[model samples]
Target: MSVGGGGNGEILVRVENLKKWFPVAAAGLSFAAKREWVQAVDDVSFEIAKGETLGLVGESGCGKTTVGRTVARLYEPTAGKVVFDGQSIYELPAEEMRQVRRKIQMIFQDPYASLNPRMTVGDIVGEPIDINRLATGEARKNRIFELLETVGLNREHASRFPHEFSGGQRQRIGLARSLAADPSFIICDEPISALDVSIQAQVVNMLQDLQEKMGLTYLFIAHDLAMVKHISNRVAVMYLGKIVEVADGYELYAHPVHPYTTALLSAIPIPDPGVEEERRRIILEGDVPSPINPPSGCHFRTRCRLAQPVCSEKEPELVDRGAGQKVACWVT
Candidate 1:
């Protein structure tokens, strides 16, 4: 998922057989270090409508974040197509790709590291506008002010450095910078993972409001099932770089089919103490397989409780099970 979220207007982003692999040198210090490829993402595909929040959820190292970055063309894909607004993003020439930056943007996971401490908030927010030559003089200043205000900050904040703000405030500054270009699509890459629990709700609510006001598209990537359910129109569950299930949020929560999806949904805490205590917990055994040499057939078979002999012989395809729900497990 792109972490890009809502216009309900049209299909704005399509990822077809997207793959990203990082070549790793051999572990030994010998002269001949055999090359190995870490399959961060393997043939992941999805589509985001103009106005929708497609949540990509999974445990750490499942390539959920990589999927978002690849969709935005931040990391050059090893193979496959990332189509945005009817254009092939990776096929575009250098000049054209640079121009496309104006239409798409990303809010990174770490606000403290993403913002430059030396530059004032104004400089940080104005960088995009300056790079794209979107504004100049007081016009630029006014634009920066407007962006800051849009994110719940003030014009006075323009003079301060990143270190002057708290974690949540820094994140707000990051959000302001993402909107500096007035992008049509934004990838919110775990934007709330670093903030306080209380602050997370504030930021999420702000994002929802901004979507309504700007008609922006978002791919929201996170492991927080509750938050994803609240913000996303659809949700995808990924395991070992492959999506195992996807569907509308309500349908997914109500009737998850894949074993991995069921385990994930089972882990979400119920609101009521009595219900939470009574609900069954599906504890998955074993660790996630190494992506460099993932298990044959279904990558999730090793950890799935419902694994069968057929699971080791063929990887199930993600097919529609009904009601817009798709699952990759044969038993489901």
Candidate 2:
């Protein structure tokens, strides 16, 4: 695998105008038919400085996972740049890309489905270390044991298969695998979404502790606003394959700018029934438009209650407001 020099300064990962569009074929005769596409991630951009956690929040099917995958180079982008530790991954040779894998890893959304049912937990955790030639024999086994313990699982559990464990344990095993390579960055793709509600906080807290210990940078993708707020240093709100707002986590939560963002924040359930009942809910109108044929200008305009004529005529650029806050809307 090819290996480029480490990136400049503090930024560990940078994505520039990233786009991943899946092609859609013509239904019938294609002698002269034009190709169609599903814009999974359209012109999204962001950066993760070393040791920082950036939360990505959005409704289901809003391309949040696609952005994470595309940024990690799991999916070959249709257009855009992904620079890791100063190297442009898409521009690397196959072998070079393989080497880069050690520095970047991902924790999948479904804990049960993510782990290989046929493999023992020890083997699953040790696979990355083996692939990277980081350890072997007694050393590899020892490393696996250490990893299992690190993720809050007992060393004895390593010999068991994935099916023998519960949802949270499976996720811990998956996390152990990601850490096998001692990656500097991880894309957590809704890592707690499938676990029992009670188990979610344990995983999140474990991830936080691991991040602090390893000095890891993360792109945390999820729809759980409350969890995101607790874990993220900064947050970006995505809608219809586009980022509508990006700001400090607390700032964004306290003062959402875009109409879509406002609507989303409003839907988060407050714990106290009195407070929830007192707050006004902003219910958005209309369904999310098909990615294959999104609205002409701002994709969210179709459902935005405050959308104006200018929103349909031209796409609003993501402009900075202050203190690292940015919003893509005409009226905020």
Candidate 3:
């Protein structure tokens, strides 16, 4: 319930030096070719307090979704730790980890692809409940209907399939299913990117309401900077599989420290014509370096306008710059 993730200093989720790398086959048909690794998430560290929403924003291929999946334990972490509710999840046994899973859930992007076409809305929402053995018979049915109505869907529509509903409705069903687990922390990975503009607001508002009611913690991942600013207590900017800056929503937007964060904030358009015309956009040169073979020092230095000699020789650590704002830049 705090503004900048400072709620009694109680950390519900802590990710430390997390890394997820996938093996990429060498090009062409060669027996002796070396297999390379695509560093999707590299040494990413952050924390989400109880009842706090930490928005993770970056461009496509920035490994935001991968971070969410890794935290949810969908992908086996190549390195580092993911601690949930004071327990190290990766180190837990199978049965113990199964219990931990019920407390951590993920709402994936692409509502259509995420849901099973063969399953009805009711079945999709109730699957988690059944898996966890939370209820049965009439009790299970009532729980499903309650979840449906809670997400602003008609109880009668439960009998219908995913194809029978619109995109927004399908997303609502996804929300219902995530809630079915009675999760304490939910990773929302671009949950609204596939919906209409108006529907995006509706779903986001509903998420805020549910978080308030259920006292849930969220790691909201998305490309919508404005939306992230609106929903998140704190925002973390990622680039080239690494977090560049982390700060309070207001502080980050008003005064971005990292060069990449400043450029990203500049790209968000202003509605007012006068302000839009006067605003100076910091357009960086060069494309984002490949994660497979990132730059020597700072991954962002190749595209950064303020890149100095040291930036290419030494990678900067994420040092706190008062008021809990952390930045990984030599020049900042």
Estimate TM-scores for all models.
0.96, 0.96, 0.97
Segments of candidate 3 deviating more than 4 angstroms? 1-5
Clash pairs, candidate 2, are 1-95, 1-96, 2-95, 2-96, 7-85, 7-86
Which of 2 and 3 is the better model by TM-score?
3
Residue-level lDDT of model 2, residues 1-332, one tens digit each, is 01111233388888888999999896689679888999989998888888888899999878999999888788999999989999999999989999998889999999878988999999999999988999999999999999999999988998899999989989999999999999999999999999988899899999999999989988999999889988988888899899888888888888888888889999899899899879999987767888998898898988887888988999888888777788999867
lDDT of every predicted structure (CA atoms): 0.89, 0.88, 0.91
Please give the range of 10 consecutive residues that has the lowest summed lDDT in model 2: 1-10
On TM-score, the stronger of 1 and 3 is: 3
Kindly state the number of residue pairs that clash in model 3. 0
Off by over 4 Å in 1: 1-8, 29-33
Report residue 248 deviation for candidate 3 (angstroms): 0.3
Which lDDT tens digits does candidate 3 get at residues 210-250? Answer: 99999999999999999999999999999989999999889
lDDT of 1 by residue, 1-332 (tens): 33222334588888888999999887889887788899999988888888788898999999999999888888999999988999999999989998897888999889899999899999999999999999999999999999999999999999999999998999999999999998989999999999999999889999999999998889999999889988989898899999988888888888888999999899888789999878999988878889999998899999888889999999888887766678888676
The lDDT, on a scale of 0 to 1, for candidate 3 is 0.91
